[model samples]
Target: MKAEKNAVLTGAHFIDGDHAACEGAIAAGCKFVAGYPITPSTEVIERIALRFPLVGGVFIQMEDEIASSIAIQGAVWAGKKAMTVTSGPGFSLMMEHIGYAAITETPCVFINVQRSGPSTGLPTLPAQADMMQARWGSHGDYEVIAIVPNSPQECFDLTIRAFNLAEEYRVPVLVMMDECVGHMTEKVVIPEADQIDIVERKFTKKPPGEYKMFETNESMVPEMIKVGDGYRMHLTGLTHDERGYPAMSPKVQQKMLRRLVDKILLNEEKIRHIEEDEVEGADIVVISYGITSRVVLPAIKKAREDGLKVGHIRLLTVWPFPEAYIRDLAKRVSAFVVPELNLGQIVHEVERCAAGHAVTRLVPHAGGAVHEPVDIYDAIKGVLEHA
Candidate 1:
């Protein structure tokens, strides 16, 4: 399906990442949004509140993050694509419902415009600290797709991708943007409605009496029916069988959990998005994501100028971690240098995947700012000396 003509603001416009994300959601057929206004991310909902009504959509400023998170799920069951936006602190409040979304197979987007934090840290500053939290913050074992964007243009592009992935996988998809990207202004090209592809909801084709809410075949994703569609639906957070009713036994628990995790794990290659350059026989590969990906480019250029064999890999999709790809790359590279806004979050995933095949070094930062080019350069040179 294509975007609605009215929703696709078809032309080039100077916009910030927050506003671009709002336009992206609208372009992706998202008709309902429920979010609380939080720093760095508030502009997203603000634009949605203003623009949604014009597109026949609804934006509600919920009482809190908790309500906002679950409200989007309700909207999904009611037959509309939906989303919620927040920064780190509000993201923390939404974790439980995130788990609920996963277990119930609700397709929705969660935009976390990341800010510095373990608590209510610097709300206005950028941080990539939530990379780990987005995947592991919710309790229990479930999988989700997470994508990060470095620029306002990509902020628009990837948010549409996030919504598409959510509908395709029937999992909560996250658009992880940092404060710098969210607030930075850039020229964004909004293509025509026909140029934008949309993944419509997979509504069940079976008649009401023949439909089973959570039934699936080879795709590992079940067909969905809206709340008033004459189908009986019973979705719960507990372990369940093909039917969406609760089944508390261990066998049902194992089957339910495996399906939820395997659907993503099995289709990982299709979901993985990373950009690699000059990695062939390179001694050091710099791994980074989000704003840090943009920040580390100069360092990479400097390393190449200094006669060092260096390459770069920017993670466009952070969750699922691209474990197999990193494991393969580790076999050829001498070391991997990970630079993130957080002290050491994604670097651990690199180290684990490298698994002694190559040295994994972390150029850590404690948030509020990005790493200097010299810092990343020094790590690259240091890895060469040690390796």
Candidate 2:
């Protein structure tokens, strides 16, 4: 599907990543937004509140993060594309609903502009600490698609991608933007509506009497029906049968939960997006995402100038973790150096994927600031010197 004409801005604009993300959501046919303002992420909904009205959409500031999270799911079931924006604390509050969205197969976007913290740590600063939480915070054995943006332009581009993935997979999609990317201002060119591709919600054509909400085809993704559209739909976080009713049995639990996990795991190749540079023949690969990807570029450059073959891999979609690619690359590379704003999260995934074939080095940072290029360069050199 193509984007709506009126919803596409269709021009060049210099804007912050948060505002760019809002424009992307609108361009992607997101008609409803429910969120409470949170630092470094508030501008997304602030722009939505003003722009949604012009495009015949709705934006509501719910009482809190929990309300905001669940409200978008209601809008989604009512046949509207929906999203919510928040930072760390608010993101934590939304975990239960995230799991609900997973179990019920709700297609929605969550824009989490990550801040420093376990709890309200650094409201205005940047951190990539939520990398692990975005995938595993909700609990249980469900899967989600997570995309990270390193700049304002990518913030605009990937926000639209997030909604499309949500619609395509019938799972919650997270746009993991750190405070640096969320607030960074740059030129973003939004093409005409026709120039963009969109994935509309997959609604069932079966008659009301014949329809079952959780019935699936070969793809393992179930078709949806709009609420109040003459079709009966039942949705819950509990283990459900094909008809969407709680079955409360171990058999039903295995069947339903496994599908939720397998649909993503089975189709991992289709969902994974990683950018690799100079990795074909290199001794060390520096892996990073979001803001940290940009920060580590100079270090990678210096390592190369110093004659150490340092490859670079930027994870565009962090979740579903590109394990196969990393596993394959590990066989050729001697070590993988991972740097993050958090202490160490994604590096663990790298270690697992490397699987004893290669060494995994972490350049960890606490929340408040980004890593120095020297720190990353030293890690790269140290890895190579040891090898």
Candidates' C-alpha lDDT: 0.93, 0.93
Residue 387 deviation, candidate 1, in Å?
3.4
Residue 95 error for model 2, in Å? 0.3
Off by over 4 Å in 1: none
lDDT, candidate 2, residue 207?
93
Q: Alpha-carbon error at 36 in model 2, in Å? A: 0.4
Worst 10 residues of 1 by lDDT: 229-238
Worst 10 residues of 2 by lDDT: 230-239
For residues 214-291, could you state the per-residue lDDT of candidate 1 as single tens digits?
889999999999998778688888888887888989999999899999999999999999998898879999998999
lDDT of 2 at 144: 95
Q: Give TM per candidate.
A: 0.99, 0.99
Show the colliding residue pairs in model 1. none
Error of 2 at 312 (Å): 0.4
Measured on C-alpha atoms, candidate 2 has an lDDT of: 0.93
